[model samples]
Target: MHSSTLFITLTTALGLVSAAPTDKTYNPTKTSAASRTTHTVIAGRGGRLIFDPDNVVAEVGSIVEFHFNPLNHSVVESSFDTPCQPKDADSFFSGFFPVREGQSDEVFQIEVKDTRPIWFYCAQNNNAHCQSGMTGVINQNFDRQEFSLRAHKELAAEVEGPSGVQGGIQGGWRIPNPNPLGGF
Candidate 1:
């Protein structure tokens, strides 16, 4: 290969590696006690298409554990401004988990990269989950009830079909259902 071509390829590879090093992995056992809380969020609990609590506050090193239950549901990252729409293809997404009735074995664990408020929603396509206000946030300082109310209104204007980005950020972990019926 030409020297110039080789140099370009190496530069691009190194840039990708350094862009988000902190997003790679975290050992909770090793993390300080002050930054190691684990917050749980139930998805589709009680057959209702909503994230239980719908709002949370987590520190930079905390873990957000999402438990999927009853029928099918998904977790997709979004922006407070967009509400129901996907923030970007590269953003976090817990693909449709084909959870059995009364069962809740599937869980997705995402580590917080910063203390910034992170917004997300259920991208269930068979119903109007997002429009029904199936959204949530972490580390938000504002009133969640008010934000949820506005999100419902925004979704009412137009509900975009959920984005198809199956994988999420560099450090996010997921246990996807293996059944072919499990929408990946």
Candidate 2:
């Protein structure tokens, strides 16, 4: 009888261990309000094919908001090795945002899930924006000088064409621009 009791206890403990959540699971709602920060990144502002403040160091649970300016542009996630191509099908992408003047009514935002670097670029091929040096990075590893944003941009210059997903992916969010006039 004692052996049976011990067996049951071990089984229950094993079940609990198996049910434990892993680091891969992220629940945005559970993140503390005080720990959350919003980093603004302007896209193609002032008719320039660039992401103002192109390099940002954002913590996990923080949001990187990409505000689109006049003309059309998009933000697509890519890996450091492949600068202009989408990192994967699950990568985050902000579908093209076109504005005649001023800024777009919407903004693209992605939450930082980990400290690893995230490379992105504008997939606007009409003017070859990505090839022209429209790229940005999030949480870049400063210690690795060889894998810097400048190097990524250089690699992007060599790409024949930059490509992106059909539309926005699951890893990003597109919400109404809080400041359409470029305030704050």
Q: Give the candidate number with the greatest lDDT.
A: 2
State every prediction's TM-score relative to the real structure: 0.65, 0.78
Question: Residue-wise lDDT of candidate 1 within 53-112, one digit each (tens)?
Answer: 677878788889888877778788877777666677667887777777754555778888
lDDT of each: 0.70, 0.85
Which ten-residue region of model 2 has the weakest summed lDDT? 161-170
Q: What lDDT score is found at residue 25 in candidate 2?
A: 65
> What is the overall TM-score of model 1 with all chains considered together?
0.65
Q: Which stretches of candidate 2 lie over 4 Å from their true place?
A: 1-32, 167-169
Highest-scoring model, TM-score: 2
